[model samples]
Target: MHILVTNDDGPPSNQSSPYVHSFVRSLQAAGHTVSVVLPHIQRSWIGKAHIIGKTLIPSYFRPGTLHKDDGVASHHPFEDGKEEWVLIDGTPASCVQIGLWHLFQDRGPVDVVVSGPNYGRNTTALFSLSSGTIGGALEAAVCGKKAIALSYAFESREHDPEIIAAASQVSQKLIEKLTQDWPEDVHLYSINVPLRNNVAEAKILYTNVLQNRWTTGSSFEEAEVEEEVDPAEQEKEIREGERNGTNGADESSVARRKQKRFKWAPKFTDVHESVRAAGPGNDGWAVKEGIVSVTPLKANFCHVPNIKGEIKLSSKTSISGDQILASSSMPKLYAIIDYPDPYVQPLILSAIRSELKDLDVELISSVQQLPSPASPLLQYRDYESVDFEHALDQPRSSLLCAYVVRKALIRKHYLSNTISTWLVKHPQSPLKTHFKAAVNFELDYAEFLDEALVDAWDLNDSMTRNEARGNDNGNKEWWILKPGMGDGGNGIRLFSSMEQLQSIFEEWERDEENSGGEQEEEKEEKEKVHSPSSGNKVPTSASYGGTMTSQLRHFIAQPYIDPPLLLPSRENRKFHVRVYCLAVGALKVYVYKEMLALFAAKAYQLPSHLEVDLSCHLTNTCLQDGPSREGSVARYWDLEDTAHGPDWKEKVFEQICEATAAVFEAAAREQMVHFQTLPNAFEVFGIDFLVDSFLRAWLLEINAYPDFKQTGQQLQDPLIGGLFRQVMKVAVRPFFDKEAEDNDSQGSSEMRLVRDIDMGRR
Candidate 1:
């Protein structure tokens, strides 16, 4: 996909803004075609002002070619298809305008726009007025395209080099995830990454803007001096000579030309009253507390008045008493006994009970026994139910359950199967048939394996791991490997030699043999064997082969990614992304709101190959090794260091929405098929992504059912509650209508029978 990359930092020629280069490079790495446009000179804080009545001309900036000491060329200019740099002698906002109007015109409309790694925080009231970074993003938003403004705030400028480098890294990760998974509604995002060595340890706070103003100290000072002749008279004489257009050797000219100097001293006054208090839980608080704040600011801030009018209640509104009676008599919804897995069953039951309270619900083993659950309100013994017998007779009962649900929902008109049929017919709705089929949920790994091969062939190594994971302690050679499927670094083991692998395997075998027994008995035996306090317990090196070895079934070997550098003054840091997504066209709004912004201490170190092998960038709270690990699992808002102070929750949501939008747009362009399905039929999805030190976003996994428990609790406010209620209202209304209609039809028949019996008795 074609992307326009610009920043307030200007071009690469400017040493002050080095992140622009890295940002462009990361986009290219993600298979996006990139074009860079930036200012020739620094124009910091130039908010959204544009040059009027002046044509913007592109110019070349030669900061001089960078080269090695041996005279080897380290950089060269692009001659034809690509340019090393294009500089415009205008504001950052002007640069974005030129790119959109001219540079991207021939290539078709730009998909997404990214702005900055601005030097400081842009929060609270300053956000709307932030001309430097937000200006470009606002320009993009105005153009009806999604945009993001990235920034970094640090305690001191001394550590800028390290901070800039880290910003670039994390920025890349953010861009990747944003371009691939963000939703369509979000127009723009403002992201602020706090500058600290322990970036991985940095907490991501979704925050609101802090409207606090900085206090300015008075430059006045107390002084006693003899009064001098009025300087105003001298200035008037000089102005009179200039107006007369005379270098006349007259008295006035002479007086005007005379050198006049006075001591310019002012007494220093006390600093202006501190304007620190803006509002509660603002971005300033988060930044002060050492957290990365992400804020989503809406383009429009108008509050339209609600005109009062006559309240016209809908005709369909049923009488409260009648509706209550009907609701009470409604059929009890029973839980389908599909999966034997105890884990999922309870969750399903909980959801059902919560939604269908007062309705009878029972667990039935099979279709034939479905009618055995005695309830006056509900009954079932139909052919469709009998079809379950054939369905469950399959290899995977879960798939069978999905199929049955799909069939039932379709039959009852709860969902449209027509779209599924259309998809089958067209096969190439948005992307090529193969790519479309590959993304369809029903098509399993086996079906998509061939398509995966084709995708791999087309993309080459782009789809593979970008870099070998770096090891901690600055050692590049020795590394700790990790399995892809293992959670919490469970299957990870050091592999300095083949002997270690063999020994580990042997130990695993011994443990397996010792624990083997009947299913239940074996489970108990294995649990005892792996217990932490077991007597004569195996050492770390020896325990590697036990359950850990088995956990390596689906894994990837990698050199451990390094932990972030630690600075003494800052809070311990860690970062993770909770991406929410919905199907492209599915109905029933699946809003995956809220996220867990987790963090861990700098001292809470993971082992390395040399020292027990846990040093890595895997920031999952479940993976952290420390006594305080349990507290790492926090709601995004709670992750803020209250002592230091910013409430970053709102800002984080805004950033997520903005980044997610950019990602969805980019993904649509790159993977056209999935894009076509978006913002329509689907509701929402949560994508777990990780940002590396370089700011490059890496896709961790796509969760169909992103846990909403934490989110529901975090955003327990009325606004969120209203949104939830709105969506639920839309989703279940049809089912409720169907129930009402059936009740009406049944009631009419019973009354007719009653009348007939009365006539017969007379």
Candidate 2:
């Protein structure tokens, strides 16, 4: 392997610095080519920093030269050797940068950059925070190279050649092992070897940097110096003396005899105590036990949550944004696409691949082989886990979806209807104009109310029984019954009388007691009744009536709109508008403008009795049995173009957006626990709205994890694909790409922002 070596402790010497030369030789002996670059002077305790604006001149140092007074001869006093090391008049981090990119062009690319074999041990956070040895390695990591920071711990400040040789060999072995089998997502490693005669035989342990802070006192003290020394004053004096052909030493001595000074006199008692109290897995404790400590690290700051998981802090995988941008190979990002919907799965996967195409990110689809801390693009149905949760839940899979939508929209109709009622009660609520009147009750309880009592109950904002009876044409009121926590048009019934409503529940109980084979026949029998030509046989029971024992308890009953707006171009079929909305991060709501109009299978007709066919009353395409209903789904924009007035659809769309914002706001305000707005989570909802002949849109209901497959192949590309792509840009990209922070794309042009409630104060 090709290696570049650097250190905070400059070139090797008998004192101040040693071991670097021996370590380099050891690596060469192990059949690895090595190049060296280092600071011209000691640069300890300075973190990862470049000296901004300075001219760094390179000087050569010969190995094994003897030290002389007068700051060692200008020609140097170090080792005498054929090999030459490059010395930089800058900090350790600067050397790594210059060494990797500018130097070693003829030697080919440097595979790994090794920093240190530092003079003192860098074990805990206290020392590591300000260590230039680790800083050099950090710089190399940010530049997209494998790096290791090596330090030698000594019992005392004395030289031991035998111990140094043993330590060097140990470090070489560890370095080779790590280079061959480095752990995933680890940016760099910090290794500390105890300098002892038997160091080569010591056990190497994986450890964590001890999280410690200085607690006793300040690490500086006032020293009684002869005078104050100013760097600018000294520099000027040196230049003036140089022109006169004399050194500035005598002139500087005279100026320094003026005032007192302060020196760094650190109080290490607290550090020592903390080390002693540390656990065995800590880097400091491992070194104290005469073992080598290797702490793998990421290039980002450590984030501490109020609660921790089963995994240790050291074991979690992390990657820095710098590494992501600088890396040559594609970054591997794993996504779990576990949804079984045929129409939605392939389209979403394709969209994700397309959105991240420019970044050269590899998408991993196998859930079983994922690396720790996988990407946040999980598109699964009703799946959530703490393992996949992020600061912002995006790409759908691990999203805590029930928090803001599913519970408020589908779980209990009573809760949703009550929330809608609360929204209308506010004088300024848009729902007052767009929301439909509805009531919720348990199916068992509703079975007990008589026809007279049902009519006496407050159903429509205290409208008189005669007024609630019908419209000006005197048609009796019709109601649609929906099972609480039910979806996909299951156990839904349309009724015009209390007798018909009570009989629907009775049919469900009979279906539940029948055999599985008998239930199938009964289901087919029910489907046959949906056709208008099939006489007055009520198709009151769905297949769900037999299996919905748990969810059959609660139900919502809403007075059905009699004359739903029918388009002449649409063959006068009854249809409902399906709009997609997104809720992000503590209450920011947006509506996707490209909506879908789902048409019922048959032509529209006002219902007057229990003999009503759901094919005429329900617009869900899922209920339509045959492939003959190819035109069931159409773009809302196309419908808008065909409307009588050019602005009619646009005006209705405004009402839809307004009503959507109002419903979400009321849900979050009233049912905070069930509809929590988490900063790290977002969800897409399918909201259905009904339109009257007057072109007024009314909020009907909300559906969480809406059926994207219902959009069908014809509209999936522009509707579903665009939605997933925009979601990736708005939600997932910012975590891995920094450029996404400045350009949000405003969640793309299709999504319209309606409500924003900042939860930042919490």
Candidate 3:
């Protein structure tokens, strides 16, 4: 193949333009005829610009006859007879034009144009948009030829010849392959090769340019001039350059510019930091990871598809270039919508569309179905994984690089048992006033159960407490028993006496036995019927799915708060505030201000009988059936209309935030084993809180993957939708997009940051 080679970095020298000579030699050694053309001086960061009115003067360069003082030898006249390279007094793009249409005609129509093997990397949008190396390739591509822009990424200023040679060979192999089967729509390719020892064996991946911006001050600072500089010192510096064989007209001439000049010194430290914080799978990230990157693009600006009208006809339906780029460049989101909350699934997808804007979203169904390499956002629906599985077992590092797993570690038990113990341990804690006293124990263990009963009656602290408390009296403390892992009002019972609590356990045991017997009877009936029909034994699989009472061993009983803050407006119905709190990374907590006030289906009343109607007590919307559930929820802020004072709601919100911060702090400090804060994971918790008649908020149980359906249609968009939007802004977007733009350090305007355990970024 005949190849035309041009570069933004001019002819080879000790400094700026170093690798082109070795690259050309490697191509020649591979038996490809090569013609070289380049700008007389380095013209980097000059994007596809042409010197409009100036005549492009050309000069020739010979391989071995370069003069000692000829750094810009091609700037002057030279014999064109036996010279192999042609240098033009113009831009890199002009070099491609002159080489293709004017100089290289005698070399037989060039099959392809190879630009650079540049001095340094051009990967992200910050560099690619200004890259003259890519500009030259774009020029060639527009002139109807295959083109490739090549760059060598360096860690330091020093260049190693062995690594350069290895990178050249890799480039040659990739170029041949690309040119052999080049796509029709792809005009040019921007290829970046990292300058490292193992570059020969480096994997070449097709990647897209990372769209990043310069947010660290400015690239150019005001050039400072020393008023009292010695003229002799400046003259000496000139002599030193002349003595070193430079004519003071090479790439280093930028330093020799007159006074009051701005230097081309970019704050490279800031760029390096951005690369460190960049998400995986982009061109910049690939080069930083020591892999080769190939980015295909068009020569002209991308054409936007018509989103607001009639469709046009063509040979066939085709995707727009912008859509193609988006499909490949945007991160994938593996989402699962298996949760029972009907509103949550759509709300999550809607939030992703509105907040994230673009992503490759694949709706999956199971945890076992998580794709290879894993999506950036693994939005799982299983609560058990968030509670124990993922928290205990760390995910692979490939999935940990700026990834956001769906599950977070703070579980329901954490709020009850963990916070209760933590408050007891720290007597001076402010949370002691907000959290309720609870006794946690395994229902299957008799000793622990007895101990919990004793703790419930305060038998260990005061034996005469039960005797002083009358039987079934309103003065006696009522206890609400809940399964540790249960949600949606499952396995919960209200009891006042020790006999009532024990009978509740007995009832659960009897129900479990009846369920087991039913399953056995069904299994036997199936076997007996299939034994004659198939004449084969039917397989009996061990039953794993069971009622929550039979499956979960742990349970907690907390003192039921009477005289719940009842609103006069709906006939004084009992209600609880469902505050949405977001936990991100390891870890930062934010409380969503648009809370939901979930009201009980019936009016508030103290239990007069042991068999109590829970609808009068429990405010969980799931406990209400049909049409009643729809009217059971209202915006918590709306309660301000009926609130006793104007600032009463605000004070309750502040107290809620304070209690939330303390709860998470206690979890992180005390229950690190149960609540392992993974940097790649985040979760939104539905934390319940009950307020007394005095407006003092009491902490209730926490629920992960909260039921957004309970928020109802009226407040779904404002509460749940806004909650997810802020969640993405706080937890999901920062890891994958531009940090300066996407990293919401303040979370959102409404989601207040309550707790931040600054582990320092990993």
Candidate 4:
């Protein structure tokens, strides 16, 4: 395969991204054609940002002629022409974009786009989304090319070229093996490795992205002492004459930039995986064990709706209620759909690169960027973003991206958003009407299962005649209100009466209206100064009630759970569980074996003071983990610790599995009609569940994207590092498994029963 490698960490002239040359050599050693491009300076933390309408001047390093210009010089290849390894000064994403459209336009379709070997890891959702290493790969996927994002983890911040050089061959081998039978709907693989001299050979671990984050932001401080700065003489310098190219960076400036004596303030705090959410199989855990973590990620976000499930009634029966779609050995045209969501990202992609045995197929995307031959004869398989029209011209015939499902405007919130609560105790799903909730019961917190009483209302809704009558019981009733699209307990309020709820909504809506269309004043923001006085604020230690909240999208109302369970280990603070589930093609569901337990930021209490203490009712980590909140330090514990010993623990896990399976089954039954599976498609959901005082788990919120601003753990790489490996095996690897030629027979009968909805044939 011909590979083009690039990075946001730039040009050889600056000696940045010290591993680029070795990486290119390794690609050549593996018998693959390689091309390279780099920015002029380091561009870290710039996620998918592009320099549009601006020309970038990239100065190339002249091999064999070392001048006192920029940096290193080495003999690689294609140096006779100015066109090789086009070093354009641009963003990482822009490099990939330009390489595909302009640089490689005459070289034919690029077989692969490899980005990074970045200075640090891009594992957690927070870091990965912000990393140029990942940004490049995501851009390639966006443009319909096979892409790989690579990162190396190390204790030392200094770049280690020898270690990177040594790992190059290993990386090629592993990447080659992983891409052998890549899937259709899946498109990207994120790999992270730790460099250790003592370790000889390393095994790769499949894992999920750790949902973790940093606790503090950077601050400037006065220098306490003068420190020595490294001279730029350590790096080799080369001069080149290219149009719009820079001659070299100033030696004094470079020296100053590398200084170690600068004083920085407000030391950063240690990372805290959202309390109660860490598991042994995630990326953080894998890195600690010293292994290469490969996460299969996708760029699609859609909720599949429609499933006509065949129900089989039974108590504790391990039987399925749906008829399996029979497999047939038939020729099929392949189509792919890719939809990228800004905040919600896939940890890895499972798209394979080749055809299965006796399978005549061509993989393609709907986007019109790549060069296509005139009247092609191969079976054209097109992969495209959600908005484009496929070449097949058959609506719904194309396979959607691995993480996306059949989505409709109204169904978006109803399935995975706040209203997801309706599914748990859905009136039409099943049960003795015990599934009752406001607009949706499925999304209700486990602790609030039976606590749901009031129906959901809107801004236009008013008091009914019966409500106007105001019975004695009505006055005593209380309510919990939240947004259908919200997280971290941002907008939450506790209400004592309908009148109060209305008043609060009015105020909140007014605030929203005033702030909705406003843009950030970047110049003004940068000009503001922070001082000790500004940091100080009046202190308080009480929870209050009455109309108060935010997250004002679609509001959900429920009766407050009376006397909810509180963790004894956490000063009687309320908490809940955040669980994950895999719904393969919307046919079946598989729940993770572990869960996170996020504790409330503050002690449990009723609204008493003037503040509506969101930390008390909402257990989202971000809402309560900050220093601004008054709590006994935010914490999370594994659910294993919460189980009632071995035997009872088994029961608890089994119940969770069954409940989760039942919920997805209903979703499938209601959503199958709208599903158009084409051999390759799947979805993984991060569904949060909460357990009440009665020890019952209620499905609370369904998060479409896995957010790591809080739960991402401190490990070698990010969390998806290990989790995505499992996803590949379970979700996208079988389509090309000639050995498992008869595997389709085991689709619905498999132990996990992740519904494999092959569009036409398997």
* Top TM-score prediction, candidate number: 2
lDDT of 3 by residue, 1-762 (tens): 568999997888646677888887666544355789999877877989999899989876755522122433544434212235788989999999988888756446788899998888888887788889999999999999999999988665456778888888778767866776687878898889988889887877777777777765545433436534443443333333322322212232233344664434344444556667888767888888888988888887331122112111112111111111225675655544444443465455445555665655554555466555333434435554332343234342111212232212234454566766786788777688897776666666332456655545442333245436755466766777777776676556677665666666665455345665666556534432222121111111112122334457777777778888888886688999999888877778899999888888778777643356666777876655544554577888888444567888898999999998888878777776666666666677888899988889998877666666655444655677778778767776665554533457467669898888975544
lDDT of 1 by residue, 334-389 (tens): 33433232222223332333343334444444545544323211111222443443
What candidate 4 gets wrong by more than 4 Å, as runs, is 1-384, 387-398, 402-436, 439-477, 486-490, 512-553, 607-610, 622-637, 640-649, 670-680, 708-711, 714-722, 738-751, 754-762
Model 2 lDDT per residue over 1-762, tens place: 568999998887645567688898676544345788899987877879899889998887756632311122234423322256789999999999999998766555787899998887888887788889999999999999999999998765456777887788778767766776676677888889998767867878788878888786555544447456664454344333322323334422222344656544444555567788877787888888888888888876242222211111111111111112223565445454445454555445445555655444333344445444334344334445323334233433243333433476546484556566576567678877786556766545334545324543655333344345654324566677777766666567886655566677666666666737865766644543343223322375433344444345677777777688898788888889999988866767888989999998888877644356677777877666554365788998898444547888888899998888877877777666567677556677888998888888977778877888777644656678778666666655543455774565355568787887765522
CA lDDT of every candidate: 0.43, 0.67, 0.66, 0.48
Query: Model 2, stretches more than 4 Å misplaced?
Result: 1-333, 358-360, 364-405, 412-415, 445-456, 460-473, 513-551, 640-644
What's model 2's lDDT at 144?
Answer: 95
**Which 10 consecutive residues of model 4 have the lowest summed lDDT?**
316-325
TM-score of each: 0.32, 0.51, 0.49, 0.45
The alpha-carbon deviation from the true structure for residue 535 of candidate 1, after best TM-score superposition, in angstroms, is 82
- lDDT score, candidate 4: 0.48
Clashes of each: 73, 9, 0, 71
RMSD of each: 26.0, 26.5, 27.3, 21.9
Writing each residue's lDDT as its tens digit, candidate 4 over 548-641 gives 2332235566555656556576677776666656555434456655455666656777653234555566666554323533333232233334
